[model samples]
Target: MASASSSIIPPPQPPRSSSYSYHVFLSFRGPDTGNRFTNHLYSALDRKGIRTYKDDKKLRIGDVISDELEKAIEESMFAIIVFSPDFATSSWCLDEVCKIIECKNKLGLQMVEVFYGVEPCDVRHQIGTFREAFQKHERKGFHESEKIQRWRDALKQVTAHSGWTSKNHPNL
Candidate 1:
């Protein structure tokens, strides 16, 4: 009797050179503008030959943190933050922003801030709706977290940097 023969196949390897002008890490609040604006931006980036990393997979039942997500952020060349009213309300988003900023300061990662439907001054001063969101979070006993303060500092830093503003941009 002849034994069945199996063919060996070589493991696939990642491309030596990524076919992307920029490796973009998108940061946004899923429930708020995540589905709409974030999707649009991702699509546009893809069209422009820019590789973007987005969290579209569902989280595991008990999965609170993702190593893959962090790795993607670390490997990205640029981080695009979608700043909206609900952005600061998310601790996860804030943490991601902090990591991006840390990479910016330490690893020299470039960042682009998208005000979405808000103004730069609001994010800078932590006033207006952003202030309200922080206030609510504070009332809910999340004000003391280091992440919150880091988020605030990131917002201020982003505002100080040059970036496109949805409210006052000539064209984006």
Candidate 2:
């Protein structure tokens, strides 16, 4: 968490488009990286005068989840998904990914994937802990099959992009 630039190649700067309210939208598993890496990332963006939306409760499950989040994703110029060991464990995170990707397709929103402590291929294939997480999601039936499938497809799509990995950039 030295600064995102110190850890890996810095993502592109925000465009001067008037439609975007923020330069970046950060998505991560709170318990896995909230107090540590993400905070430093936020600070880095701030120091560079980049408007970043870092919602702590965005990954939280509750009545608080709403369309305002969808709006945030749409308005942001770019998104950064920090994939950690427990990232796929939360349904909320997957839901967010769906929205992030939807905007990526519809609004030309760009994305940066950071495989924080997990393998990119594992996420792409849903293996290891990702496999375990999906199994639990299916067993619990907390969401419909189509919804779960969308999450899987989203993971596949996200991982296909060229991304930064902790395996390659250990300082991240």
Candidate 3:
């Protein structure tokens, strides 16, 4: 397995200097695209020597830690969020989404969302599976009302950015 730093070629010109440890931080639901789309994308990026961070660590059943994962996000030049069917269902994934948006806002970290077999409208509006996920989150009440609202805002804010869909950008 190639560590993010292992490279056959230099990374493309990003806005940042060599202070960045990785070119991209990949955020996704493991079960949805881990073995398929995200995996393939990571592999392709690796082939191109684009230093990328994909969380392969098994997570504990707690809030997404602000240590390694957060550090990786901060260290990367940009992020690619793979919004799949069940992405919104996981609190951890939603948490990461919030953190990614935070980084984008505060650190000027760029992000490009990829709607993988999902609709950007659905994500932005919280319709379809996304709607269901939020309903479940509300019913569970595991998170504070304010935290949930932040997640909602993050979703809306993120989807506002121009991105590629599997249907339109089939080449990826």
Candidate 4:
């Protein structure tokens, strides 16, 4: 993974700020699970007054992630990564995951993974759909090589942490 620059990382976070702007920041591929599982999770979080951050599609502007999105991730106390089958296909999602990891490592921010129909092992090892995503990325000849490595490393790092898998109940 390439090193994140100051432009990507938000300003230095205060060491002892108990008041976070959000309770959770949800990360997922919009096309895959936005209407189904992610929407339900967002609704549940809202009902509980969790102060969650789910990107407003209307506010999204470009392929590159916006500063507002980065600030949201930094301000959130926790992050929930919904690893759907097509999650890796979108660079925006991958970049978000990378930033989530950065927050976790530097800010001691908490994160949990929900393997929504995808295997944890596949995410960790970059196999199956994950493999396909990487292949497509390589063929595109657009993304920086370092960024691609960063995405792979981010995937491995996040999957190493404790997470729930759909293996037990495929219906979920």
In candidate 1, which residue pairs get closer than 3 Å at backbone N, Cα or C atoms, i.e. clash?
A: none
Ranking by lDDT: 3, 2, 4, 1
Regions more than 4 Å wrong, model 2? 1-3, 6-17, 57-63
Q: How many backbone clashes does candidate 1 have?
A: 0
Best by TM-score: 2
Which digits, one per residue and each the tens of the lDDT, describe model 3 over residues 64-145?
6657788888888878899999999999889889999998888878888888889999999999999999999999985688
lDDT of 3: 0.82
What lDDT tens digits, residue by residue, belong to model 2 across residues 1-172?
A: 4355444435455553666777788888989988877888887777878788888634355635547677788889888998999999998789889999998888778888988889999899999999999999988985687888999999999998989887875665
Residue 50's lDDT within candidate 4 is 65
* Structural similarity to truth (TM-score) of each candidate: 0.77, 0.87, 0.84, 0.84
Q: What are the lDDT figures for the candidates, one per model?
A: 0.71, 0.82, 0.82, 0.80
Stretches of candidate 3 above 4 Å error? 1-18, 57-65, 169-172
Off by over 4 Å in 4: 1-16, 57-65
TM-score of model 2 vs. true structure: 0.87
